[model samples]
Target: MIVIFQYLSIILLIFLPMPHYLRESYLASSMLYSLVCSNSMKSLIQYYYDQ
Candidate 1:
């Protein structure tokens, strides 16, 4: 999943022509990343509490 995201970032950086769409995609990617990170952290905390 990280690999796919990196490829997407590279492709967007290299081939994107519209400034507005590029900005929108960048924001979308960052939001997705944060959501994934938060989910992982939540699971980690829950595991610790369960121990």
Candidate 2:
């Protein structure tokens, strides 16, 4: 799943002619999104495991 996101970002970086600052913002936002997603997923899994 993480590999898919990595490949998507790499493809976007290569094909999209975004400016340097835009690229940085995109990367930062994506990283934050992935972090939140993973954290929530972990908590959900833990909840189920505890049940």
TM-score of each: 0.63, 0.79
lDDT of each: 0.80, 0.88
| lDDT, model 1 | 0.80
Off by over 4 Å in 2: 1-6
Candidate 2 local lDDT, 4-46, one digit each (tens): 9777897989899999999998888888888898899999999
Model 1 Cα lDDT, one tens digit per residue, 1-51:
865776787687668676878678786887788789879989999999999
- Give the Å error, residue 47, model 2: 0.4
lDDT of 1 at 11: 83
Clashing pairs in 1: none
Give me the runs in candidate 1 sitting further than 4 Å from their true place.
1-18
Best by lDDT: 2
> Model 1 clash tally?
0
- Candidate 2's C-alpha lDDT? 0.88
